[model samples]
Target: MPGGRLSRPDRQRIAALLADGLGYSEIARELGRPTSTISREVARNGGPGDYQADRAHRATEQRARRTKTSQLPTATTVVEPGYGRNPQAAQDFQEQLAALMVQTGMPRMAARVLSCLFTTDAGSLTSADLVERLRVSPASISNAIGYLEGLELIHREPDPGRRREKYVIYDDVWLRTWQVSARQNAMWADTAELGVEVFGAETPAGVRLEEMRQFIGRLSEDMAGGPTEAAINDALTVTAALIHAGRPRSTAELATALDWPDERVTRALRDADYTPDLIDPIALRRTESGAYAIDVRPERLSDVQRAALRDS
Candidate 1:
């Protein structure tokens, strides 16, 4: 029973336990189910305060019937090649991920759409494909796509020689999302600072606002416009190659050593120079021969230490 679907009686018992002031874990223990299962069930069914056993049971039944009917033998209901995956397991995983996303403040339809795209092998889907696979209205898919695009989590691209556009999740989706978050943080910090000015500096509200501004300002400063993971990795690789060479190397030589193009090597070298903190103590410098070399800066030492080294 713990691994099976919740029955109508189970819903009744859960409602009773909730009315008795029992927590999710307590109800789960009583029902021999996982706490997450109990929590998710209650959350989706009008929560504990308004949960009704009969209504929740009916809703679950309707959803199941709709899903079953939509998945009947039809052209759109055919399963894709699984490449050895169990269809039921994949479906369960997708549902679980969508539930988690919903818990994190995403709308239910939007979360479902995002999860469906993520689970697809090609990482892109047209509106028609989404509608067919999700068994939802085209308008629902359109709204979800707009929401995801606003958050920079997905983007639209024109389908090759087709009237329909596809929603694509690129490899750098999270990077763009992080940048959007950083911009939002900066805006919050600015607004908080303005609030501090609106209220008197010595007032209680001003103190709170000032503190918020300082905290978010520091976060924005750290997050805004930072080097991407790809750039950082390239810089480190180039630095290691130069260090191992034990001498200044031309861009062409470095490119050949790393099996990269000369332009790519140049870009890596430039990023290393700009973000020296990624490779502290060791610095990149250009020699008179127009080659790059690793140089250790002695400026990190105290004046007395530098004088002592010079005397030695």
Candidate 2:
């Protein structure tokens, strides 16, 4: 299990269980562990953590790693190994990766599922595979996969010869994710314009709301005007090369960076995507160095668009 990171207290209990003469298989059955885990645990900690549950648990984990190292062959092999085949290594890696992903703002179960998926060579897994991989229920796998799909981090594909569907990580996952973000921004701009209608443009409340709306709207337009992703990427490559070469930017300097004109660059910055305030288009202004930067995150409402709500 992905979700099973034995806490300090849990490890302490396991140590006590082992001392009671419970066999490794029995302890695993009682603790819902794979038998290998119980055997490894007792072998790792030099038998106990001074009887303190927390201290003993940490000691056990540290010992496990040392013990594992001793077991490896001195010579490296061509095929390293599937993590799952090495019970402790797989368990520790999955748990560690899951914890890191959660710290980065992913939900716990979702992170665990993602960790397992990434670890596999397939770049995909059926729901049953997820359930087995994470030791989670079918429903839990379904829910996590749904959230991953919503984020465009994963998508479902048919499993040939099998009735069930497999969730897959797309080859162009990052590009597809970026497109989803852009589409969302465009939607927000549309809502902002509607807000101006709901609150009459002349009213104080309406003015404030409209200002917010216009800022987002303009940002959306600016994003739309920016060079297509391929062009932008080429520009980034040239920019990086310029930095490495220690060269200054000139009009002709950037012309070779991308085929786009200076005017297009100017308009792209004014794009609502670049300036949330819509208060000052000047913020979108280019520098003499030909670099463009924005002071704020482009407006895409955090809350559901208020304009979507119909009047009673």
Candidate 3:
């Protein structure tokens, strides 16, 4: 019965997911069917672009009726509901969430996984649970989990009692996405600024590039935690101390280096939302040697370290 004819809701989900930019393979995985099933259905229903849920369902009913004379009865099985979500409503919501995630640049499988976790009451799922619920392969679940983790949408929590780990979405997950998006904006701004110099700032191409640089730089500043003039001025005394320290320092380091109370230095970065210790827009970078450096080139950092600077 698992691979039996798809229901009307299933067709609706397929149509929705197609609109969300999911490929056939991803749809099949989500619906617990073979890839060819979706491929054939889509092709027969006017291809991906024109496929409509209501039309597809009507076509399927017509086809079944046409073959009714030759049909034979098949055995059936009874199963109880595993969750409270109404089948049709749940599938519809999943499709919509998947579409939104796709628009935000998440791959279909990863979107499916994150949406599943987000909707659950616990906001968590083990890899095995994902494979079973999505009716996908273990490898597919693994890959999707990894991708979501990379996006900071989910994290792995060790469950020693069950001897399995669960992937979880935190309350601040949306904020983390903003952090990653801001860093990406910064990267683009840097490239656009470089383009302005290459094409001459007065040239048409350079002018366009300059506009891009300016817009993105402003976005990056907001992402980097913009503080008011009054806020910056208030923290100026402590912030100035870090500048002439002659070396890179974290909160603890700065406190020790300047013989100031640890909490005072810690509070400056938190309250002022300024650089050198936190979101260094134009100041320091972590070097290959694992030290925060003002002059040294940036190193390819781990996801954890990159998150500290702003998400990767």
Candidate 4:
């Protein structure tokens, strides 16, 4: 039921309606637009809580220039009005997209440029193409492209036919985004686990920190696609210590103690780099015979344990 693109006046009306506490469906009905369109628009522009008519209108204008850039009448070609019926609808869509990206923590100009690349059917754009389409200064385009490249969201490539550089979107872009998230989750889990130890395991703060550790740890594992080499190394360190406690541990025991999957421990043990010195022999004793599958060299046998390692 969406008609021509929303004008600046239309955005102002939407904002006024939003301030009056109307829902998206009610607003859409008032504006004569499909509910979905209104929903998306509101959601992208800071949702119902923060929608601003002027900001949304400006972002819409920015989007319009980018899409309509292709039709900007080259020497051999004439500009064609093919973006949308109202020319303003295309802009509204672009502003919404850019706003959504910004909501996910991308810089505004960078998000706008990325939105342009994402919406284009060809999946590529050049410096000239962007500058022409967005009607912005070349410096703005350059800075946005640089920001996007730094974040691994886009790449610069040679346009062999034109001898100019172009930005290209990777087909597996979301995979790269997930990888970054996985790394952040891993960091968060590690920091939270450390907090649990510092705050005392019995304290409420420690208990809350442990919950955070568990949540982010699981997210790290799930987003990783598989067990990473670093994860394997850390697991090996824990397994080694448990085995050196003078008893053989079942796969289930290791999994339960470390809060990891049984299969992961098994895999880490098979490929664990035992060369790394994790435990100090001066402060700890070797495991009793037959405790470990691998022949860990028994050294500096002692009954005394460090305060840090002692239980109870």
Q: How do the predictions measure up, each by TM-score?
A: 0.57, 0.43, 0.51, 0.59
Task: State each candidate's clash count.
Answer: 0, 7, 0, 1
C-alpha-based local distance difference test score of model 4: 0.69
Stretches off by above 4 angstroms in model 2 are 1-107, 150-152, 158-164, 218-312
Candidate 1's residue-wise lDDT over 16-52, tens digit each? 9999999999999999999999987876665666678
Better of 1 and 3 by TM-score: 1
Model 2 per-residue lDDT tens digits across residues 53-154:
665476557656866676688944333234655656665676566666665567778877877777777778899887865667999988888888888788
lDDT score for residue 229 of model 3: 64
**Which numbered prediction scores highest in TM-score against the true structure?**
4
**In model 3, which residue pairs have backbone atoms overlapping below 3 Å?**
none
Off by over 4 Å in 3: 1-87, 223-312
Worst-scoring 10-residue span by lDDT in model 1: 75-84
Question: Which of 1 and 2 is ahead in lDDT?
Answer: 1
How high is the CA lDDT of each candidate model? 0.80, 0.60, 0.69, 0.69
Q: Which candidate number has the best lDDT? A: 1
TM-score of 3: 0.51
Model 4 CA deviation exceeding 4 Å by range: 1-10, 16-23, 29-34, 40-51, 54-96, 161-164, 228-237, 247-312
Model 3, residue 19: distance off in Å is 9.3
